[model samples]
Target: MNNKTSSFLWNFRQLKLNICPFGSTSIRRLMKVDPLKLHKSKITYQSNSLQKPQSSVRNFCQGVLAFQLEGNEIQKRSLSTLTSTSVGKLLNPRPLSFDSQCFLMSNTTPQLAEDGLKKITDSVEHDLSPKEKQLDFGKQRDLIQQCNSMSDVLDVFSKYPRFSCCNYFITMWKIAKNMSEDQKRVERQLLYEHPAFKQLCDHVMKEAKIVRLQQLMFTLYAVIRIGIPQNIYLVQVLLRVVQERINECDETSLSVLSRTLETMEESKNVDALRAALRLLVDKQIWTIEHILTLQTMMKCIGKDAPYPLKKKMELKALKELNKFSHVNSQYMFGALAALNHRSLILLNECSKMVVANIHGCPFWMLMNILQSCRKLQYQNLDLFTAIGDYVTTTFDMWKMKQVLAFLFAFETLRFRHIGLMNMFLKRVLDESQSLNQKEILCILHIYSSLNHFHECKNQEFLEVITSALNTYLPKISSLNLLKAVYCFCLLKHFPQDPFNQLLQENIINELLMSGNESSKAENMLHQVNACLEFEDTSVLQSIPITLKECSSDSFFSNVEVEDVLLNLFENKRLFLKNVQLPHNYFVDFELRMDSKRSQVFPVSEADVFVAKPDILRVALLCVPRSAFCFGTTHPRGGLGMKMRHLKALGFHVILVHTWEIKRLDMNPAVTFLKTQIFSQEAFPTATEFAA
Candidate 1:
């Protein structure tokens, strides 16, 4: 035979000789019979060879059945339920007496010994416990009771899972949140690792409806402090409950509810804010904090508050006006502006009160009040004078933002507090380092507006501005850079050398990458206004120079003004193409009038001054849609000063517009202007006609 066939036959013969060859080793051991009995029976079997194999198989099956029955009995009597004495005896099998040993040896088979070994191993494994929870019962209870911070509570929960289900979860968090900052910081670290704390917060939120009002507030306070995830449904549920029981809430409870309402995301459930506002206002027990909350709510609700509700709120403010301090009055004014409510009566009284206490008012509070006045477009000379005097005397104490706000409001009102401006210039010299990028832009904007009346020739102010530009230009945002450059052009203030190069590069980049075309044109005009000899003109190619290109730049530049005048003259129906002109035709035409001779002086200008009459000047204006109401109506500002100067010059000025002519028929508007200018009866009483 070949080697492979020989090897296979030998392996097959060895396998056939082994006992219980079909099953695994353990199974075979359980089924095995005693070898001594089998050997003894072998001789007998040889004598009766035909019945031997069948008789051996029958004996092996009986042995397996007996072992299975004994294993079943052991399982029924589990090791956990057995007493310690039973376990000890089972493990040691108390040194069997001579008679017992002899009986066990005579009956036991290999299958019985294997079953006994399996029972011992199973009992030992089942008796062992986890080491994490090895503490005694009293010690576990004590650890839980003494828990103070999140660390203590979460640690106890880790050891004993049952402690996580206790009723004191909310109470423990309350104590934890009130701990020291250091302790809380440590606890916060632990809170992130354990997920069961989040589960506890969820449990408290779900059970909030059943808790007392104080406890509910406490729960919210703790959750907010712990920085738990905000639940919108829970907030809605709390709001509903508070609304139902609003009458039962005292001042303290109301305050807590208002704070909680403020903490919620404003875009979700704005109705809750409105409801809180109505409740607080109805109570009429106003505190400083309540007023602040009202301001926040007004901002959230905006102009959507009902008219009747607004009137009621106005009445409440008036009723409580006398009790308000400077800060409260400031808040009340700001709230009125945010809600877009007009209360001139309250404003008059509030101003008088504010003037009385102007010296003692905080700088921030005074600034807030001025911001409100600006919003209302109100011009109270006495209030302005008082605040101006205080700011002028104590200019050193004001911050840069405060100074900027004062300048904006004062300039808007046409209140040229000269002492204030001088003090402001001097103070800026000392506080230049404190000026930031935003303040720089504000300064430029105010200076641009003021330059309309007089030139900005203050050297120190210019120097401070140039210094700030050099320090912060690289970090400024693109849009703000455009605005800053525009303001600088208007004020004729440009940075020097390397900073100028950087500004040019940024402007070029912005223009090239600009997505909006209209904004680009408007920015281009400002760039042209700030024309330095060194500005890079390459970026100007992208923008088409056109008038009225953007709707936002409503106030026209010189070029736009000229274009508008040209468009008006081109309309042939007006019949004014052949009128005579003076030697110098100017945009800012000064008229000094008298029956004998004209008294010329520096004064207001007509937008398109065609002819300066001794008693009648025909002036054309292109006022923006917004300026007619809020912008030009300041008492001593642009519109007011123009009217006063026109009257002082003894000129009957005729106002004409080309933009609004589209709304009216061109023929009738032309007829109206012609009649007023040509008819001698039009100036019967030296009248100024505005068309």
Candidate 2:
């Protein structure tokens, strides 16, 4: 009998390995079989004369078998080390042969050891009480695999205690749902509404004390993926379990738990998030997955990580960066960008890796890498050019928003790629119908920023936008509608007919609702444009003179003069007298332009003279280029030609330097004007006029 039990368990070990790779470990630990002792035992049958001597060995084998079959807590405690004691050492081993191996592998179900082994397995299962039978991990795992409905799965859960097969059942549920068809998935969707599901949830919540750490993590992750709303009680229990076992979790387990918590959107849970953070902060190195999870956690907390933690993460990332495929690198770069990490060296290294792997990279990943570079303001011309070149080739493959998002990235970083812009415009024109209101507004914003309004020369693009306006304007949000109106004004063009009416109506209401004096002034300009389009001056009397001051100033006599004065008054702090030159150099001896007349002066095809405003005595010249760029060739072209003449006429030539625009605050011109208006120091000499 001892020999029979030893041979049976050995065969069962082989079968268990074949059944489940993970289950084999539990089987080995549970059986406590000594391979060396089994190998030394000689095969023998019970002889009639020696039956009396072998009764104890038979009784020992029967006692162990009975204990395993019952698997009750009391019996388990009593026979804790029974297999490791002298009882297990009495096992009899048999020699292995090809015939026996074939039989064990192929004929495992029935007639195993010629009915003797079958009797042992049958007796072990059939003789157990119903409650003890639920401890059978193998049978429960099988039932979970074969589950066809939510009720079937819930039934399995009901049979076992909360912790017994929670992990395995949840995993199997995910696999079934993910692998099922739409109809089958709909069938499984019933799980969320099932009463049994609520019962199971309540069970876990009430009995969370019995759960293990891995089981808790797995259960939470499964819940998140299934799109169930988590119970607050369950979440509290999970966090408590994590707090208690924080020291016992290894790096891999910690990474998984943090990622699971993030999926749960519980990163804002102060206690739980900090517990995971403390464990991960000290690690010197990490796998690529851990690097991804660590950065995600950093983003969730939305604070700068400690110096040591950040340095270690960068070091680990640098070492493993080369080994990551493009997808993983996308995750890495995006997470780093999300955390607002500013490691230039690692960014440069990642750029090189991305460029090298550009062929297989998807548009979204490429966009992510570019967006990261834009956010960090990390400039790598080679990296940008590589991605730009790829985008050029694959331009047609991207969707409308993707193309626009890609363009916006470049626009924000001030990296101009003209060819890519052309491709993007062509795609947008072709796919305009697919665009939504938000997308159209975005495209317009991008185009306006790039000064690509000239590309709107395409009649097809114009027609598409014109067509979309009717459908899009009413639905666009207020902020974006304001932006769209601004784009139209910036382009100095509006769409045709009914679309234009819709746009104008929205714009008028938005501007009036703004309550800003400038917004009312802006509305006057739109009205002026409408009146001028019809060549109707009958309505000009209704236009307020103060509103006329905000109109676009243009000098037909001096083409560059219009832009300078327009930029000067753009700050809206001080009013300016628009300067006009004579149509023929001999027609007017002096340049004198009135503010009200200059408002409509740019509309004339021929140059005209107008009187100066009473408040203007100074001439402000805007030099768009830096003084350094005024070389010998173009010396007298921009500011040099105008500076001397204006100063000779006794006007203070206050030059607005366009090259210093970035360094200037919101109202540098305003500040300069205020200083000039109050200061006792006289206007600077002509030598200082080139400022």
Candidate 3:
């Protein structure tokens, strides 16, 4: 108890030095609590003779003035009566890891050993529980894995209350992670919330002296997988354990530790552990032989890793990639994903390798590979098709996350399997309740990108999603909300009454007013685009923000195709360039047909354009290469929406593929234009004269 208390004071004093070290803010944070309680405290301080840097004569005596310490019965005596740091340095203290003890001191020693750390049972001993006597560590681990339900596992725990710290930790973690998908989230939540789990955490806190490093590391990993580790007390203990004993960690442990701290980037507590992990990994990086550990280190450190470290890692990868291609599919996937579009040539070559040898890979790894290829935006048709086939045949085996990831890849890839999407739609609707916000958004993004608003069956899917989204709408970020609205508006449809109610004038005004410049501009654009699509002028009447007219409409003219067609038009009166239509659409060339179905003329020829409402209005669209799928003439979902929107606005939309003008000679282009403008059955009025 004394050693742990001294350790806490020492750490708090160290924190005081680094935190502010000098300013008035220094001591204020440690005692920013109720003034009434300070008056009621029994103990008082006396100034120390020493004049340290941040610790003033009075500040040096601070232990705790009884806010939480009073609750714990910790303020029994004054700090003036407490022993000096030099006297307390004689007591051995608990360390961040096992097999080492870093005692409380004013300063720490430099560069330590890299010996592996595991559990070291303390001197304290107690009689074993009957269940502990029956089930050894291996048996306990096996029982935890074999148990079907949380209650069964609790039965095991209730029987054997005491095991080695590491054994107890593994037992709890295995129980937490091993559950059916239907019960996975619910059961894990219940497990963490259970009294047993709370007791486990409390036991660790009370028995910090005896707990091992692996126990702390695995506890953190379990919480990350199970739920958010919001308990600052528990987290601080684990981090300090690592910080004080970091030098004793092997490269393997450091690699794992880096991966853990990677997620806690927001906390200041893990900074020391993170720095220690980096320093150790930098020296030991070359000795790493396991590909996945190396990949994990690179992934966790990411671009922040030193240039020398990154350069050596890449160089090492370059040698191992060739061997990984033939031996391990997972290694190949990691290699390609880690590179992440650095070399397009390698991306394509590795994609070809995946296509040739993807059959043996697991479904989880295969999903990652597919997502990696999609991320690189370099799709090999065979690779996507092969995996799609494999997933379709074994669709029942894939989890919802895997399905969501697979569908998300469709946003850019030219590939689509109708049967796959159909199965996915049914799966999504049935599992809609289980879907989280991001997962639901991925589904909407995919379907919207495919222009599924026109599909009847997708309506119910949207409804389920809309209902689900409305419940969690306020909790979602601005980017996701905008994305949701964009998906619905792009598809020319939206959701239920509640979702519609959120678009009330005041709500929209608040969104625009409260957000950043980019968010405000984007929200305004969505409002403008939505007004154009649905013709809801009421929503636009009093909008707090306005986007530029051009910003509201994403489309721009394809200059190459437009120029070719403009040169073909003998008279500028025949067509207009950059014409704006009713629904925020930009027509590259707008031509009209006369009453006799013979002549084509620009709107300038019309004395009153509204009078000839019966006449055919043509939107001569110049579709750019980027608007289509790579290596194919198939239009992407966004381009399809444009053409659909034009048709909705009552235009006889005509598409001129950019490649036709860019790739072909003038004579061939002229022939193509003639066929496009005047049908074989129609009288050639402008086509004949233009030729």
TM-score versus the correct structure, for each prediction: 0.50, 0.54, 0.55
Residue range 1-691, candidate 3, lDDT tens digits: 5544545555466555633234344233332211112122121113343243243222332432211122213222323223223211111212222111111111222221111111112112324445456767786677667776565565566555565444455455566566566676777566655656555555554455345665656666654554435333455665665665555666667667766765665444454455445555666766777766767766565544556555666666666666554434444455445534244554555667766776666766776776666665666667777777777778898887876677666556756655677788888788878888888788778776665432456678778878878877768765567667766655555454333444456555556566465665454355435444543334332324344455525667576665566667767677777776543457787778865556776667343235466588776777766665455554565666566556556666676776777888877887787677766433223222111
lDDT of 3: 0.56
lDDT of each: 0.49, 0.50, 0.56
Candidate 2 off by > 4 Å: 1-138, 148-152, 159-163, 172-189, 202-212, 266-270, 283-304, 319-325, 453-460, 470-482, 496-510, 514-691
Return the clash pairs for model 1, or none. Answer: 489-530, 592-599
Determine the backbone clash count of candidate 3: 1
Q: Per-residue alpha-carbon lDDT of model 1 for 1-691, expressed as tens digits? A: 7545554554354433333332222221122212112122112222332432221221221111111112113111111111122211121112211110011111235586555434433433333356633655566657776876666676666555533233344545666767787876676667755666545544444445444666666555455555544443333444444543444555456556655654565432335434544534444434434455455545433465666557766776776666677666667777787667878998888788788878868877777777778788777878888888998778768776777788877766555666676666666677788887777777666655454322253755777777776787668765666666655544444555223443555465555466775366355443443243223334432333232322322433433334333343453232222122221111122222343322222223332243444434433333443323223322222333233234333444433333444464546555654453345543323222110
lDDT of 2 by residue, 468-569 (tens): 765865566555555665454333345544324333554555655665654644653443344333322342223221233232333323333333334544
lDDT of 1 at 360: 69
RMSD of each: 24.9, 20.3, 12.3
